[model samples]
Target: MNDDGHPTAWERGVLERLLRDTLIEQRRARRWRIFSRLLTVILVLAVLGLLSTDVTVPQVTSRHTALVQLNGIIAPGTDADADLVIESLRAAYDNTHVAGVVLRIDSPGGSPVQAGRINDEIQRLRKLHPNVPLHAVIDDICASGGYYVAVAAERIYADKASVVGSIGVLMNGFGFVEALDKLGVERRLLTAGAHKGFLDPFSPQHPEDVAHARALLASIHGQFIEVVKQGRGERLKDDPRLFSGLVWTGAQGIELGLVDALGDADSVAREVFKADKLVDYTVQPAYFEKLIRSAGGEAASALVKSLSTTLRWR
Candidate 1:
């Protein structure tokens, strides 16, 4: 509508420009959506690739040494726990190509129950695969529960300075009765059974409870002594101090017949297995499993701290 009342060329040109810009914007948005979808697909593929790699079993050779690491605390939810160690042992033993298995241990020891489970599994696996001799190569320390696990091995090797042996059981706790008395606090604990709160730190110490605890520790210690005797057999020295909860250096361990040889994993792999190639067969927990376990562990630790008074292995 120039001067008359119809339409203006300038207005129509402006409208066309606006329409073109709208079309461009729409195209850009569509392109962005496609790019985002492609990126998501690539990320998913990468995650799948990583998971597959983790799940893949290593190829073994007849001349290769299979390694199962027992590092860190040997307790439930730990790397050297019974479940993981046992699983690794099974994998190493099951592989027909593996000539020998080595349990590389570097632990300060933990739960007796977990250690016992691992020791039993090792014995079972040894019986099943007698030819594939399993050996324990101690690192810095192999004491208490760690030694318990090592005894199951056909031979135990250690460095000259490696600390070995702590052949005993103990249950440690702090007495809070004095502290409570100082604070004028009286612990009002009610139990259905006479021995239900026998070992409570806040309560008065009972002679009968002390005796019971000692008896329990003695029983576990006897079991540990029996295991060592069975595994080492004639190789173990007939010394009373060997099982007196004393730690000895690897050199001393050999003298006491606690260790078979003074060697490391590499030496054992080369000389004993006759193979320099070592393949790890340790079963590591998945990321998700670890996350879940960590959360659960916090809750469990709190519960145990609140309830359990005794019955723990150093």
Candidate 2:
């Protein structure tokens, strides 16, 4: 016992040994935790590396070029976008091992601007690669924008039951003045110009606004018709309704001269391109991109739900 009534030197030795042993254990535990974290990081890095690098390079033969898929809606930043598709097409065209390309299209159509851009790209690529033939294989449906894209190809092929051809423009919306009145809701809109709110659904529609919109649509529709005519050449049948925003079956499409032949992807690949091997260059979103997108969607949904609940309660 010391002067303060504490442990003696011998007693302090045992106490220090116990404390030292506990400290050592704690240090070992921390080191193990750090090692485990480092191992996890290494494993994740390995996986990411493996996924980022393309393991299999597409084998191109002299028989034909790479086959590409153009499925889903054709829009900017989408799988069927013109810029992305064109990049792949350029790759196929530039590939010395490939002889030609077959574009497999399956879509209900989207964005006239996007389709037009794609059409121009395809035509330009074809001009550049005059010898390498590019053919279109229409799957389920290739209407409107889809048909527009197919027109740029050397020939359009589809099954007898496939839906095709809606070479027209459409703008859809609704007027809700009556509904707002029934709900006793007031719509307050302020605009800088007289025609700024011309198409406001809450207010009564102006005849001039309707006329203006119609004119705009008509102009777009005319452009679409001209493109189709240029693509089909003199093969287009005497059907005025072809550009009336009316879709048709594959057989009907052929009759209207919208499609050149009737066949599926495999059939076109085998008969037209003469190559059975298919290579898809459609760029998919990266894992991190998908994660970020999913997280963003979740956050947006949660915010919307919170807002909806608050509005309902109020």
Candidate 3:
């Protein structure tokens, strides 16, 4: 159309460029479709995997020591929570070929209620399966409520260096009255009950509230002492410092009658139970939950590493 009926050079060049652009665009579209389909398949598989993580009892053909790990803080919603431990203990007892059971504990302890629940469940399971003896193996530190859970076991083992015992209850918190004053912050609290605002951090510490708190702690401590005495019986020594919130090394614990002997989970499985092969009966969290928790822990670690930034921001 450029003054002649023949095809012009410029018009031919333009056609070639347009055709190349269209081809490239088509290639891109095809790649994107493939990527979308791949993503969809991955998402479906992940969903299925997460949904199928429920615990199921498996028949064992050989005798083994069933291991149920109690790690981290003994709080609700944690790995060492009562529910998971109870389920693991039940599962360990349910399996027919289990020669013995081991509750491996590595915790500084938290939530006395959670620990008590686990202790009670352990006792119940042991009573039902008396033949399958269960032993508590302390890994690193097992104090406070951790000992509460361990006391229920038929026998407790630990490494020579492992920390054991803190048979006491504590309800600790900060008194921020001075901090609020420095920040020019006013605390306005309302409650229907007379002691509803007990141990309020922003208010001045009341002698009555302090006395009440001490009494509550003493009651829980007394309960803890009773449980220990019932479980340990004559194994525990008559020393007053035994239940004074003082931790002792496993070797020292044996001397104090807090630990049975110096041995790890492996030794207990091999020597005490005579079963070298160990089977894990601990109920694990779902994959998705684990990922989420791992991510949260990493974020928390990062935040802690940037302590100055966190303080400044607040």
- Identify the leading candidate in terms of TM-score: 1
CA RMSD (A), model 3: 6.6
Compare the candidates by lDDT and give the number of the best one: 1
On residues 243-297, what C-alpha lDDT tens digit does candidate 3 reach at each position?
Answer: 8889999999999999999898889999999998888888876777667668796
RMSD of each: 6.3, 6.8, 6.6
lDDT of 1 at 312: 47
- TM-score attained by model 2: 0.75
lDDT of 1: 0.87
Model 1 agreement with the true structure over 1-314: per-residue lDDT tens digits: 67788568888898899999999999999999999999999988876654331334687655699999999888766677688888888888878988899999999888889999999999999999989999999999999899999999999999999999988888876688888999999899999998998788888889999999899999999999999999999999989899899999999999999998999988999999997789999888656556655878758875777655655444
Between candidates 1 and 2, name the one with more favorable lDDT: 1
Clashing pairs in 2: 65-100
Query: What is the lDDT, from 0 to 100, of the residue 311 in candidate 3?
Result: 11
Over the full model, what C-alpha lDDT does candidate 3 score relative to the true structure?
A: 0.84
Error of 2 at 72 (Å): 1.5
Q: What is the C-alpha lDDT of each candidate?
A: 0.87, 0.76, 0.84
- Segments of candidate 1 deviating more than 4 angstroms: 1-55, 289-308
Candidates, ranked, TM-score = 1, 3, 2
Per-residue CA lDDT of model 2 for 117-208, tens digit only, reads: 88898899889878888888888998878888898888888899999987777765557889999999999999999899877767888999
State model 2's lDDT: 0.76
